[model samples]
Target: MGCGACMTTPRKKGGERREEFIYHRMDPTDVHAVARKHARGHYCLCPIHGPDDDADLIRDTYKDLGYRLNHTEFFMIRSLSRIPRVVSPVTLKRVTTIKMAERLAKTAARRQILPEHVDAEDPPMRVYVALVKDDIVGWVNSVVADKATYCGGMYVQPECRRQGIARALLAKMLRDDRKGGARQASLLASHAGAKLYPVVGYSEVGTMMVLTPKKK
Candidate 1:
């Protein structure tokens, strides 16, 4: 409602113009509203041809939803391993205070990421973050469901990537998953993120296909 705007724009393939709409970012309520419009309940996407490992499909998904692509993500799961590499130089902690959430919100805003209310009173979700002198440089989190533990919300400061911060964050996620009696951990990884998950013992189970809504 208060987060989007619309205007006319030329089509990508032809001379005809069309209305372009975008939701710069969505809160939890906004996410649910889209799902409700789609069907009776939450829905998922199915690839038309197959996984392309490109951003085009994801882009279309945003256009159809009247939202632009903020991140191109892939799907993965943690594989069974005798040992998971423990990366260092970063301390991990679960987000539990408003101060932490405020800091994370600022970081996500700078990155143009979709914001989630990660720090709330008795929050239902858990977010683990990597701290560098009380500043969040990287983090990961998961939501446990009846079927599996879906891990996401992974981010590392631009200057912090490739420094083992992501690896350390994921390792902590897996540890938390096991601690909570979860047997499987899954995540939708961004294109750049695909590289980081594998090092933490996750494998590509399948490629994710993002589809846009059709015109009426």
Candidate 2:
């Protein structure tokens, strides 16, 4: 039996506040009951990841309940033993303060910085920022668990890309993870990221599908 998980976020739609339920790795048998219980008067999204046949069955089940494909991503992973030692032209700094996280959130247009961004708890999380002349231009973060690091929230300003900032940030994060005892890194790569991560040593392991209710 696959274990199901959900995350809820509040959003504003047409001047009205609503919630969105995002389900991850949910069991197929539990989908309808859970969706009915939590998705009333709200948006719901299910991101399925696994073997093709299993994912297809879950997708078909959602389709029968009026859901449609929202997007797809590649599930990529790489061993951390051989991260390239790319030198960043821009300065890189580890974010360890709420003040710094707030600045990153503002520059990245993120909703807000949470306590966990700087919390020193187990399953360690780390955020790194790229700076040019004291201004943040790119950032990336990772969370380590069970000897693997999951990387996400990677972004580089439009004007600052193609100059190796993204590569630098990734290299720095992966190297740090390796030093910290993580043996591998994983991420769900968007279309654009699918192109970039391969250059950094990640290999596609599977496809992930994001499904949402069809507009009526």
Q: What is the TM-score of each candidate against the true structure?
A: 0.60, 0.82
Question: How do the residues 1-216 of candidate 2 rate in per-residue lDDT, one tens digit apiece?
Answer: 355456455343454334444445655447766676776465565564655457767678879878887888888899987878898999999887888888987787663335675856553688899999999988998977879999867899999889989999999999989988899999888999999998889999877676666889
What TM-score should be assigned to candidate 1? 0.60
Segments of candidate 1 deviating more than 4 angstroms: 1-73, 80-85, 110-124, 214-216
lDDT minimum window of 10 residues, candidate 2: 10-19
Worst 10 residues of 1 by lDDT: 41-50
- Candidate 1: lDDT over CA atoms? 0.60
After superposition, the stretches of candidate 2 with alpha carbons farther than 4 Å from their true spots are 8-29, 39-43, 47-58, 111-113, 116-123
lDDT for 140 (candidate 1): 73
